[model samples]
Target chain A: MKTRDLGSAAALAILGLLAAGLAGCAPGFDHLEIKIDTLPPLAVSVDPTNVELPVGIAVGITATPFDTSGDKMDSDVVLNLVPKNQKVLAVETSLDDRSFVLFGVGPGTTSISVQVDHESRTDIPATVKLQPME
Target chain B: MIRKLLLLLPAAGLLVLTGCPVTDASTGELSNGRFAYLCVDSSDPTCDGIVGKAVIPDLLAVGGAFDLEYAGDSGAGLVQVQPASDVMISSTAGTFAFRIPGIAAMLAKNNGGVVADFVHLRGVDVDHLDVLGESLAESIKTLEMTTGVAAALAVSPRDRLDARLGGALAYTWASSDPSIVAVNMASARNSVILAGIAAGTATVEVSLRSGLKMAVLVTVKQGVPMTTSSSSGAGGSSSSGSGSGSGSGTTTTGAGGAGGGK
Candidate 1:
């Protein structure tokens, strides 16, 4: 009786070790990683950088983005323009062209912010003063 | 027997998981920093009709199949009037007709005046035409004749205008010597002219002597528009995006293949 009991205990231990090995081999999940990089910091650059324009002239805002992994992230970018603490200028993305256009801008100090992945980036504040149309 | 079976099953599962072949994700090739003029409208007589007079670099990809049309044009209708020759049209203004073969042919016939003569060259000095002074009207006329009634004159490298003319104008660059000026116009007439010029293998140089002498060089070759876009990876599959904007608004989501093979 004692020998039979010892034999049964040994068999159970061997089976338990096999089951543990199988569990270890089962597929295990790994954490996913996502990253992003900006090509040029969000900023407003006048096409001429500096220009004399008549009042009520329309100016365009161009923004570009870059990624470290060499991945194109154009679709994930956004642009917004706030004028004189009133009226928000929202821009639409042209991912195919990797560009956005902000049209019909009147001269004044406007706050421009670029957002990517929900993160907002504002350019160094600059005055956009337009010359009064003669 | 059961113990051996369990061990074997674990080993088999491990083999299945670890032995899968890895795949390298497709990556975008850096644009050769080149552009092409594509007439995407098939209905425009110039769809694949003629090769415009613009000499696009050889490293670029040029096609008109994906070009967009004006507000009231149908995508299918534009494709119907496909051109048998080359054509050129303005990048700005008016709906681009894609289906008229006659339109394409016309563009190919007139491409030299519209596309090649109109491109702006950086680092080269151009005589600035003051649109507000006494010379404004004459300057506007010269610009209109050079570009077209619908074309506007813009500062090179930057599209900002010193003045907005009522019509079109071709823009071009002067070669190393101020002796050769090349203009590019974005229009169907120019595209057709370019195709005709390119087919004849002719090299035409026109010099306009005014307050300042400027030379225009006309060369025709294949052209393609340069385009770039973003990507999103999910579960080992990747997708392309359009008009995501730039900078902080961009997002990269999901799992993807290993980078650089680690």
Candidate 2:
């Protein structure tokens, strides 16, 4: 009778552990949140594909990166913008790093290129000129 | 049953350990980025022994150029500049130019993101000028040179104590009288060679693109200068001795000699 009692106890412990193991295997909401960040986006684009401004003035612009399913990525990703002719126009970074400021330095024309994580996103044609006399 | 429980306990611990995968995003060609400046010209003495001295970014001037090296595991990719318009990088590896006067960060990026970065402050005005092979006192406002000899003069940008490339290409040198002294660009853009054309006085002026100017008076002599000495009085001395043993004649002779000397 003692041996039989030990066998029943062992069987109960095994069942309880298996049930716990199955519970742990079920995916949690937190796992889904992690998946959202780890997924890579497909393409990045900048608003206002072309820009024109007067010298000595600055304007802010935004960049949007989307995924394969045409969904916009809201995660904090590294972005860079470079001007082809710095003497004509310059790109400055704001506090949030999500957006940029373009300053007109001289009366000329150049193109600005956007980069996301070592990949070329898009090129923006920018023109800077003197304001017309009032 | 006890043995089975022990085996199950080990398996449970193993499962917990393998549940989460460790992900290090900086693995492979994305780790340990470093930067350095390689000296391409010998005229800039600051480049001497600068191979490993570039642990920190140094000051630069507008229109100045430098050779920079971005060291890292690029993983089959090339490094490029990002985000600043005050500086420019060239297709040739490690060549950079300062375009404007401002504090800028030259970010070096590759396929793995920003692997290295260098921050530098650029200035437009020069603080001091140095005449090679001459003392600071001699080169401050006036410089003396021999006819047919050339003196190399270099300009230092304000607040840049050690940088030798002080926007050398942006400096314009002119002589008040080219007949007295001629100014020409030295091998290093930041320096100029003043050749004494004739024995006369002339002003050598250096101007920056931003409109700041500095001038030095240069007096060219025909040959080496002669240092003259002041005239000194002639030195004279006299001594006289007389025998004490009844030498009346000798005593009289000594007195006469003393009177003559006086």
Interface RMSD of each: 16.3, 12.4
Candidate 2 per-residue lDDT over residues A8-114, each given as its tens digit:
99999999999999966643211001011111111112244676755444444455555444555545545667789988887655323354555566678998776
| lDDT of candidate 2 over B93-209, digit per residue (tens) | 444555544443344555555323323333332444444334322336778887446887765445335344432235677888665567777666556888764556789887767
Candidate 1 at B196: error in angstroms? 60
Candidate 2 residue runs with Cα over 4 Å from true position: A1-134, B1-31, B39-45, B48-57, B73-77, B81-95, B112-139, B160-168, B224-262
TM-score per candidate, chains pooled: 0.21, 0.43
- lDDT for predicted candidate 1 compared with the true structure: 0.26
Where in model 1 is the C-alpha error above 4 Å? Answer: A1-55, A59-62, A68-97, A124-126, A132-134, B1-262
Using Cα atoms, each model's DockQ against the true complex is 0.01, 0.03
Winning candidate number (lDDT): 2
Fraction of native contacts (fnat) of each candidate: 0.00, 0.00
> Which prediction has the highest TM-score against the true structure?
2
How well does candidate 2 score on lDDT at residue A68?
A: 42
